[model samples]
Target: MTTFVTLTAYGLADGAVLALAALGFVLIYKATAVINFAQGEFLLVGAYTFYSSFVIFGLPVTVSVLNGVAIAVILGVAVERFVLRPLIGRSPISVIMVTIGLSAILTAIMQLIFGTEARAMPPVLPRGSIEILGATLPVQRLLVVVVAAVVLTAFTLFFRYSRHGVAMRAVADDQQAALTMGISVRRVFAMAWALAAVSALIAGVLLADITAVDPHIATFGLLVFPVVILGGLDSVPGTIVGGLTIGLIKMYTFGYLDPGLADVIPYIVLVLILLVRPYGLFGETRIERV
Candidate 1:
């Protein structure tokens, strides 16, 4: 029972990271109708930025985080302006291909700059453990969970109440209509990318704390796909729930099931979910006019 409790708690921590990363992917998709294949590259950039700030520049932890986020936001906006905007209104396939190409480019660039070797990220939070219900969990894991909750809450409120958020949503729903209504669809697209970058930075930081910072960390971003699909591509709340579900499944599979089963559980769940509800649990159903 204690083992189960421990696994559950740790699973929640893992889910928190997955949710943040997936949220970024969903945000861009919701606003721009573009699936950013480069989303993982942005996470890698953030992890590297944070590492540089702390280890090379000798900056404080908070400053390192801020620098990482700032760099990611700038990179996101720049990519939107230079790469995405030019290809706007093109075929979705074209856009997806461009993003995939960009991902390769970014990965190459990171390798040139940071090398392929993994680097350790300085601990952002104090190292400690606390016992809860006879299960021990690292304080850092708890911090990750807390931070994820705060970010999700803030994002929800921003979208629900803020003017900029409303504009972004309007654009997402109907870019042509938004433009007709004087909302700068282009600007909204940029904002969506920027916000997604911010989320990536947070996820990168949490992941770096748990695992070493490296090019491979970008793979974690790909894991977000299951969460995004399960939660519904357009549903923010669904991301949270979906992330938790994936995390729990991972834990249970690793614990009770065969170790190899852990690797395939998320994909299995994703397939089953799509089979039942193609649009996802919280995703909106589209009706074709034709």
Candidate 2:
């Protein structure tokens, strides 16, 4: 049906953004076993940076976008080096709380600088709609899906084939083993944060293009929690699957039921999935010998 087709397109686009956000979360967790509570703030930062550079300062889109991503990369590395490095041997809870604190701090900084106003991005993509099976989708939304897919594919290749990617993977698997093999665990950790930040930056720009640049952009990061959990905490592919599934569920719920239901549905599904498969669909299970 036309309704189905339309909802599916919208859902895929929405899901792609969530998947991109979740990818960043999963990357950090996968590499460093650190659940970055500040991930959403990174999204906020990237979106705002883009807005400030491109919209306010009248910079070229390409240069502005790169500046936003570059800022995120710097923040990521700074957080790792200054905030998280000292806590390396500390308890996971401490690191988590620190990240949560970091999120609050970042949010405050954004509010102070940009205020609480919602901002619409100027038309960056070609303004139009694409018709598919009698369903029309805005080009911006379509671009979000395409860009996300490409980024995901590129990251997948990087992880599977690249030397540094392999090093990160090795570190993820066993830090001690990776260190024994002369792979610098610290370097991989820094790289993981950098990669995660870059992912967040791209997702931020895409989501901003779809919605707007606002404080609410940070919440997108929070919504990704369910997606990553559904996909698996440390599973890259799982994040993508979870994001798309959640996105469809939300769109369908909004279309068939009430708009209010869309907001609650993902969490409901998250709870149900957790009850069924705690490790997620593709998450690895570690069995310890006593």
Candidate 3:
């Protein structure tokens, strides 16, 4: 029972963060029909930015967080406007390669600026412990779950009623039809990228809290690929379900089996799902005729 409680706590925390990361991936894919291989790099930048502003530069927590988020939003908008907008009608492969290259550039820049060492942030959350099922666990874990739930709920509401959210949803459904209705497709594209960055920024902060501000945080973004793919790349709700499932599987496997297997398991599940449903479990199947 103790082991189960511990594993469940860790799993839920990890899963919540993964859902945030995968949510960004799905937003960009759904809105623009482009895969962002640089998603991890965005998280990398966010973590480093926050560490620098809050710890190294000795800024207030609120300002530091806002600065990090601002940078993320700018990066996303810049990428959409300058790097990707020009390639509007290019092949998907071309866009994919561009993002891959962008990832390399972002990684190199982060390493050059921050170096490869891990930096610890001053603990922002209380380090108190709580009992669950006769097992004592860090209260921080529960707090993270609560934070994730609140953020996810806010996003859900934003999409359902907000004007910009409605525009984005329309664009995702059909760009041409949205344009016909006087929606600015370009603006929608930019907003999607901006929102993606915001989600990545939040995920990076959560990861920095769980782990640390380090290059490995970026690697966590890569792991989210499995979560997004498994849940269905274009499905936002899929992110939540898939993230929790993968998180539990990884944590329990690590506690009970080989540690290395935990990392491998999500990918294995993704492959099995892909074999059975190429468009993903919740992804829409489009029949494009030549």
TM-scores for every predicted model: 0.96, 0.98, 0.97
Off by over 4 Å in 3: 288-290
Give candidate 2 misplaced runs (Cα > 4 Å): none
Native-vs-model 1 lDDT?
Answer: 0.88
Ranking by lDDT: 2, 3, 1
lDDT of 1 at 169: 87
- Candidate 3 C-alpha lDDT tens digits along 126-209: 679999889999988888888888888888788889999899999999999999999999999998999899888888888898
Worst lDDT 10-window in candidate 2:
123-132
RMSD of each: 1.2, 1.0, 1.2
Cα lDDT tens digits for candidate 1, 2-77:
8898888878988998888888888899998899888888888888888889998999988888888889889989
Clashes by residue pair, model 3: none
Which scores higher on TM-score, 1 or 3?
Answer: 3
- Better candidate number, 1 or 3, judged by lDDT: 3
RMSD over all Cα atoms, model 2? 1.0
Model 1 misses residue 93 by how many Å? 1.2
Inter-residue clash pairs, candidate 2: none
